[model samples]
Target chain A: MTRIVFLGWLKEMAGCAERQVELPSLATPEELIAFVAGDNQSLAEQLAEPSIRMIINKSVLAGKTLPDTIEEVAFMPPLSGG
Target chain B: MIKVQSDIFDPGAELNNFMQGRTDMGAVVSFTGHVRGQNDISALELEHYAEYTETEIGKIEIQAQRRWPGIHTHIIHRYGKMKPGEPIVFVAVCSAHRQDSFRAATFLMDSLKTRAPFWKKEISGDKGVWIEPKASDYAAEKQWTNKV
Candidate 1:
């Protein structure tokens, strides 16, 4: 099971701030994005935006590998604070 | 120190508290950011990740400390809804010299603008627009590297 978090406009598009998904197999960040988007075309497009950031387990997701014990994953739009 | 909260804070009072009994530190620099009312913006809402916002800011604070040793820092960032002209964030740094205090304050603010996880939405009437960091902000943060 993996916890997915959506921030900014993505939360409105996803209709929820966070959700849980049980992956059929260990999936990379890209595959996880594809799976999460599923049939939601709008979500898929937003997720594909280059400015969007992916953070896994509280850190920016780096490299391509997704471990089996992965926990939380967050999708965030460009940050504008301070 | 780092604080992310919804309550409105008085930057002057916070600075006073931070400066209390700190005569040994020769210089203290502080910055306060306010919500802008451009394009008739009525309110601004700041969204943040409850779990990672402070930790990320803490990381930047640590970096600033490492970059300029013997400096003390305090950061207060407000989240949730705020009206135009209301204070949104406050950063204060103290050091033995003017250069370190000034540079550390600027570095902390620049990092907060680019590296922090807070997103802002400008509310105008019934419409709200999410804002992205400007190219200048990124460029500002980039200037803190070894080349400088």
Candidate 2:
């Protein structure tokens, strides 16, 4: 089980802050995106935009593959912080 | 002392507290960031993570002290809803000369704007928009990378 966190408008629209998704160890970012899309249509629509970023741990994650661990996965919109 | 508070601060008291028993400091430079009536299109309501904001500001102060010797710094940032003409943040740096104090104060403000986890919600025409960091702020921060 991996912790999937959301923030900002994503949190407001989904009406949820975080959730645990049970997936295999080698699940990729594409797989995670597909899973989220399958679970929540509103979040899927929001994440469809290119501005949204996927962060594993504190740093941003790029490419298709997921990390070895899913201890912290954050779906953050364009950071509006100063 | 570094503080991130929801309550308003008395500038007189803060200044006095920062300056007490500092006879050797020849110059004290301070910066007060106020909530202007107009932010792009609206008034602002600022919010911040209290613990994280204070910790980050304290780190900035430590970095400033390391860069310049014999400098004292104080930063106070207020969170929660703030109106126009109210103080948002106050940074005071004291040093033996005006140049060091002035530079340190400016550096602190620049770093705070970029690194601090503070957000502003601008209210315009009954709509609230969250303000993001401008390209200008990034441009300013870019100058510091080479210095370090």
DockQ for each numbered candidate: 0.87, 0.33
User: Tens digits of per-residue lDDT for model 1 on A13-64?
Assistant: 9999999988667567778788888899889888978888888889887778
Superposition error at A71 for model 2 (Å):
6.3
User: Model 2: per-residue lDDT, tens digit, A57-80?
Assistant: 655688777777777666766543
Model 1 agreement with the true structure over B32-138: per-residue lDDT tens digits: 99998899999999999888999999999999999999999999999999999999999999999999999999999999999889999999999999997899999
Prediction 1: B-chain TM-score = 0.97
TM-score for each prediction?
0.96, 0.74
Candidate 2 chain A lDDT trough over 10 residues, lowest sum: A73-82
Candidate 2 chain B weakest lDDT stretch, 10 residues = B44-53
Interface RMSD in Å per candidate, to 1 decimal? 0.7, 3.1
How high is the CA lDDT of each candidate model?
Answer: 0.91, 0.75
The per-candidate TM-score of the B chain, in the order shown, comes to 0.97, 0.90
| Segments of candidate 1 deviating more than 4 angstroms | none
